[model samples]
Target chain A: MNRLFGNRTAIAFLVLPGVAIMVFALIVPIGFSFYFSLTDWAGFGAFNPVGAANYKEILTADPVFWRSLVNALILMAVTIFIQNPVAFALAALLAHISQKASQIFRSIFFVPAVLSVVVITKLWVNIFNPTYGILNKLLRLAGLKSLAVSWLSNPHTALGSVIWIIIWQGFGWALLFYYTGLMTVPKEIEEAAVVDGASWPQTYTRIILPYMFPVISSVIVIDVISSLKQMEMIYLSTDGGPGQLTQFIAVYLYQKAFVASQYGYGNALSILFVVVAVGITVLVQRLFRSEGEIQ
Target chain B: MNALTKTPLFDRSAGKRFGKFALYAFLVVFAILQVFPLLWVFDYSIQKTGDLFGPELIKLPLVPVWHNYARAWVDGKILRYFINSSIVVVSSVLISTVVSFCLAYATTRMVWKLRTLAAGFIGLGMVIPIHTTLLPNFIWFNVFGLINTHVGLIIPYIAFTLSFNTLLFAGQLKTLPRSMEESAFLDGARYPKILASVIAPMAAPAIVTVLVMTFLTNWNEFIMANTYLSTDDLRTLPFSIIRFQGQYSSDYAVQFACMTLVALPPLVLYFFFSRWIMSGATAGAVKG
Candidate 1:
């Protein structure tokens, strides 16, 4: 065993199988995407040499690209600003509850996170169905029949509806992070604050919140990354419909390549998607890093 | 004030009481909000097709229809999808765990020249979006004759999953004292023996984390399954549900029933292993 593994070549051999799989599965394919992006290749047709026409068109003339970007930004904003604070507050509440109650609430909140996205997406689709959806049914029962409308089908409302579903499905996850973060707060810190005449608000603000900086930063970063990569839910529910009001980068790239049959343009879109995702991730990490360093 | 006066005066007790009440109110409201849509699906699944599609705003089926599940299970071809999904998920999980454990061990424990470079190579996998590679992967898999095969799905799944798995395993194994391995060396145990008996047992929690994550991802995967598996009998639960929609249009009961069947296995697994999943997710988050 030592003879086999002690040699540098043997250690490299051990890593080779895994690395080869990744290269074959992901990296080489991406290289193909980059190569294909430079051509006018229909998914199944003869390819013509086009010198960066796909990238040029996507960057300059594509309205759908811009729409997808706008939608992604909107979803990211809603998740970060709206969802995070509410989750933080709920998590704070969970901290004060009895162990049994907290456990029950945690499990209840986490159901959506654990269930398949296919289940949640389909569930919301049925709920938002125009003709037979329960959303309309409930609205009419509440005597708000005039306000009832097709949430997923309307261009004006589609993005918001999609964002709401994403947030709703993900709310439990954010709450779980906060609850776990709060659980780690020492009891003596709270008691010390109280003995020093600091009110609960003050203690939470001055002491507990500061201690949770690391958790907050990590959760926020995860949210940003997940938000940027939002695909399955949007694909299942809207397919970037109602004239692409609900378009997201991930879904848009898929639609471009397969549905629209613009393989080169789709590859360009994908490369751009990677850049944007990495940029946002880095920016979030930088922002959080400074915030942590300042304290 | 009588007994409390012996200690420092605490004014926030009243505020803490308010905070506690507010917390309960918030938890209850959010809990209901979160559970209501799922409950609606549960209730809707049990209603007859005609009864469910009625003009009435909130139609309740007179008879609770359990055959929706029966039809989905016995008739809707869901058993095939479930089996397909199990094969893909289990195979991928095993491959990912073993490969990542070795790679992580090599990077962290073995003294080598290119260890940092190798680790960087693994880390690079995490940054590239999967959607970007789908088209090319299809072409490559086609060339390799892996298209529509279980290997086609499992290989990519394991590849995309290895970085996260490797990172977690490396972090976990790093915490195990090097002295144990050194002592094993003194006692004449081989590297594989130390890895299998000493490191593997201690790394159970990390392994569980990897298993849950890989299982959850494979079970819920849609894009690759959609793109790769073209045959009906080969579909996973997610793809199978899409098929059910296409074939059983307007049969809302059967659709819901199919959805329930697709959902129930994971739900049951989660219920039994909630603690493991929760801890794993949070631990992954922390390390990540």
Candidate 2:
């Protein structure tokens, strides 16, 4: 039995394939990415080694890089603050309603999240269209013509518009998480809190939110990572347009490498992207860690 | 029960009643905001391209221009892209799930050296976003002559998905009783036999969860497909709508139709398999 279970050939066949795929697809590429980052290769034959020059420029000289990094932070803040609170409140409201209504509303809200990112982005792009979009059209119909600005093209509104698309799609998932967490909160706790003459807000703040700390923190951690890594919606919607006002790290690196053909410089940007993603993920997880969370 | 009856669940005071009314009002408005945009998409998909220019919120064509669907399918290149998407997503989901199942079983059930480290390495892949590898992969696929091919795209899709897939399988496989496999082994059932008959049936739900998650990620994946595959035949579903929008810039109805076609399958899939996705996703979230 031991031989059968621990058979070296069996273990080798099973584990190595997955490990090999990961190493080839993930680990080895990062190695190549690092190697390429040291050079000034512009996607062609000969290239001189520029060791950290790209990094230096990106850190000190590059305004776009800073803009991208700041945008990610802004996204993280918006998701954690604006998105979560609203989703949590909506979820609380959903919980109060009958089960049937809650299910219907939940499913309806999640439709955008479940749709393809391309579809969602395109859908919103059409809605925000200055000329023919329903949003501007409706505003004009309501005699609010001045309010119907070009959402994606305008410098002031571009970042907010892209961020809105991201938030709108992700809002449902946030609500679902909070709702699920609320569901697991024991009914008896609320009953006890109320029996002690605690007001509704007091019961939620002390009893419920404390119990929901894990769910909330985990959601926040996900928000931080996703915010940093977000590229698809921004890429499809704005491509970091309006004087790079909407640039995020992923999209910025993509344009630099592929569009500008500054392959080496883009590689440098990507390494920094990974650093930020991992650093923030770890920091947030640490903040949320309480008894036994850390392995 | 007795304690609950004294205070009751929700207060019945006038202020509390007003509060409930306000909550309902907020929820209904939010629900409308959520569904209204989607309804507009359907509405516009049937309207004439000329009619779509109007400021009317809801416009119905005298005769619905159902031909937009045909144009999207034929002229927009959606059919081919849809096939490409299915091929890539299915191949990635199938291969990754099997690969992950093998690793999950090996690390969790069977004995091995450095098993925890192996599992950890696999799990670490989750954090490795595709952007990090985009340029390197572009160069790598360039050298290997894998560019613009479905295989090139599927390779990374499978690679990125393995971590989460393995996590799900490992979570489910760890909780399953070894007694089933052990008893089967006593009957001289080999690894393949035991896995197919004993392990797999038990992990079926998780397999579905992994399948759904992997499928959705690959199906909606835009950047990698956009980066790796440049040719028309190799374009995936997401790009079909984007490309259609660009090529037929003024054909708003056709663009909306293309978007609907791109969205329909996943919407249908969600409708049927939502319970599986919801329960599995929440469990995964809490555990993570």
Candidate 3:
């Protein structure tokens, strides 16, 4: 038994498959991407080495890249600042409700999150259709006929409408996180605050919120990562249309590589996107770490 | 009740009641907002466009059009895509689960010197977005004559899911009592025998959680499946749904039915195993 347990070959066999897949499929591919980023490969043809030219072009000349980054930031901000607060507040309220009602509402709010991105996006696209959309119909029925517009195709509302779909789909997960986190907040802390005559707002602000900071920061980090990687919703709905108003980094890179056949440029864009993603993730972790230490 | 007795009845009671009512209203409104679009899709899938819009312009269908689903399923080629999806999803989930379970068990229970380095390397895989790997993976698969093959898509799925699933399994393994394994070893049980009899059964719940998550993710995965597989017969449910929508752009009811069909399997799976799915998602959130 000891010999069998200590066999190095057996241990290696147990570990190598997963490790090999990770290294080959994940690590090696990224290395290949970096190599491709340095060359002018047309995705399927002979290539030339173009040193740093793609990066420089993306930085100085590409307006779409900048727009994509800005849109991603806007999304991250909306999720963190807008969605998080609403979810937290709702979760707090939910914690006070009856168990049956909470269960029912929890299932309801989570429906969107559970559905496929295709379903969600297509549903919204249909709803925003110019001719038979339920939204425009509802608006006219309410006597606000002047406000009806092609929500996804109109330049002014394309980005907002796309962002709204994303937020709507993601709202349930955020609520679930906050609700779960709030559930873990012990009753004794709230009781202590009440015994000291703390108002409801005061108790939440001073005691409850601080205790849930770990969950809050984790959720925010997840939001930042996800927003930066926002692809499927945009791809299905707008495809970054209305003249690239809804372009995201993920979709933009895919368009460059697959659609436009600019593989090298797409690789360059992806490398840069990765740098920004990792940097922001690290900065967020450090921010939370420092804040956690302070507390 | 005792806590309520400490407060004066006339002090802000009405205001508190109103506030509670407002909170409930807000929650109900948000829930409706979250759920209504899917309901609307279900409504549209079963109704003709003419019936949906008239004097009311928002009425439910008087009679359900069950044929829409049959037409979408047959003409849209959704059944083929369903088989394609099941092939990729089941294979990937099985391979990743077995591999990650072994890796997790080794990392958590064994005393290897390189374990920390291996764990850290795998953890780093979580930070790199899938988009970064897409181009190179495309090229690699194309070079190996794997493009448009289910195996091509399955490889990346296994690779991408290994890190997070391993982390989940490792976390679960940490909570199991070590004495059981130790006692089995005292009886001269080999590693394989002990693992087969003891660890596997004990880790059933965690395996279920991993399976549920991987199933959801692989089933809904779009960009990779869309990119790697180009043939109509090879496309998964998502890419096929997109193609179906593109083809039937004028037939809104059929398109909605296809969307409903594409989304129904996972949604049904979620409804049944929502507890596992929810816990896996939130746990992965905080832990990752």
Candidate 4:
């Protein structure tokens, strides 16, 4: 009896604060979101329940929602195909260098990773500005003035430019992961491959890439999640402008709820957004199953 | 031995040295591309508009203006925003760390079904987005009359991130042997005492990492803060920066100055904790 009492009291003390906060702050809000999604609430007045209409409208009629989804998918594809390959190559190069050089370059590469998103977005936006910006100025100077354009404002290029900025900021992190993973590769494996007359490219393709599968999968998963949740850079640079060319789900939903005053519809969009994000994350994890194979 | 004695392909010789030189040259060019904007921002912060752009727009700021920093800090309302940000971040850190430490300890040490249920429930929080819950909470806060306050913002922010923090901390705590706590129990120490006196010190590095992550999230957070905070005085750095843009539309110098002020604190703090930040980032990714 004493042991039970002692343990129960101890457990209560340990958990009560976190539980209280999580229930009120996290669980309750989500519950409220569900309840509100079934209503006609405009965020500042009397309201009534209008169940499931919001979801139907968003699913059937909302062009912006579909556009945001497509943009996010395009961004994800670019990140996985272009960014990861470049990052992997750089990481391999870093692994081959001397310690002093590697350390210096590692810090240099990581500056973008550690910088605030606000600074990075503003920096790139300025660089890509159409008039009086350095990019245009340089293009003109080099007799390539025809190429310069308003990168963030042009409908044709805005999404690509915004996606490029996100990948540029995130490049260092992917590089860092691959570099760190490469550092942990046992030297003996490389030596054995060498002794067997394996070339450098073959060693990397056959032996090293297999060993680094877990890291690669993790980075891919992160990229997928970040792609689905990308709001800040898009919001800052373009604000889903030029007719929502650069729209992402996170920013789009916020605009609906706050700006468009369609609170219930926004909530429905958000719930669907969550389902897609979680669904993609789980799918990626299962597809890889590289975790168990990694020793 | 004879085969091993043949010239090594990856020799530390002239060819390799030249190859290294090529690699360094590539890295230097990339570094310049990466750092160019930041250097421009810094240089622009000191100059007038005339010096900013020219036929040769790449020239360094002709006359440095130190007043931009002073004006940004004073008139731009950055100080107020900084204080507001600190209030939310510090309070969130202190509250989350204490609550999570206790919860993590219970989840690891308790052999009870309730503990299992509690941890399981928290795990669902990992995937829930803030947008999904924002409207409902906004409605609730209006009824409770808690809207536009630091407390209102802190509550949801901490709640939203608690699961991941608990999972990180609890995984680390579980790695410690149970015998240490059992011995403490045998010697007549209480659970809180064991956590306070024993577990915390050893788990210091992990705790620090969690704190850094929490700080970064809070510092960079804009969505919740923008929604919840209606008062100018309660706005965070990000919110204030947006306002700064509107207020100084054409003065690119002052706008860049505001950005400099906004970017400096986190940059300086990151430099100090660069190693820990890298380790924390890698560990979180690898462990996940």
Cα-based lDDT for every prediction = 0.83, 0.87, 0.86, 0.81
Residue range B102-130, candidate 4, lDDT tens digits: 88888876767787789887766766666
iRMSD for every model: 2.6, 1.7, 2.3, 2.9
> Is candidate 1 or 2 superior in lDDT?
2
Per-residue error for A143 in candidate 2, Å, reads 2.4
Give candidate 4's error at residue A64 in angstroms.
Answer: 1.5
Off by over 4 Å in 1: A1-10, B1-22, B54-62
Extract clashing residue pairs from model 1.
none
Q: How displaced is residue A69 in candidate 3, in Å? A: 0.9
lDDT per residue as tens, model 2, B1-288: 588667665657756878878887888889888777777888899888888787586687668889999998998788788889999999999999999999889988988778888877887786777899998988877778888899999899989988878878888888987788778988989888888888999999998988897888889998899889889888998887878766899999999999888889999999998877776666656666
Query: Once model 1 is optimally superposed onto the true structure by TM-score, how far is the C-alpha of residue A175 displaced, in angstroms?
Result: 1.3
3 or 4, which is superior by DockQ?
3
lDDT of 2: 0.87
- Model 1, A193-223: lDDT tens per residue? 9999999899989999999889988888888
Chain A TM-score vs. truth, each candidate: 0.94, 0.95, 0.95, 0.93
Error of 1 at B35 (Å): 2.2
- lDDT measured at residue B269 in model 4 versus the true structure, 0 to 100: 71
Among these predictions, the greatest DockQ belongs to 2
**Span of 10 residues, lowest total lDDT, candidate 2 chain A:** A286-295
Question: What tens digits encode model 1's per-residue C-alpha lDDT throughout B1-288?
Answer: 577655544567776777778778877888989988777777778988877667776656568899888877766788787889999999999999899998988888777788899998998677777787787887888998999888899999999889888988888888877777777777888767877898899999988888887788778888888888887788787765787788788788888888877778878878887887787677655555
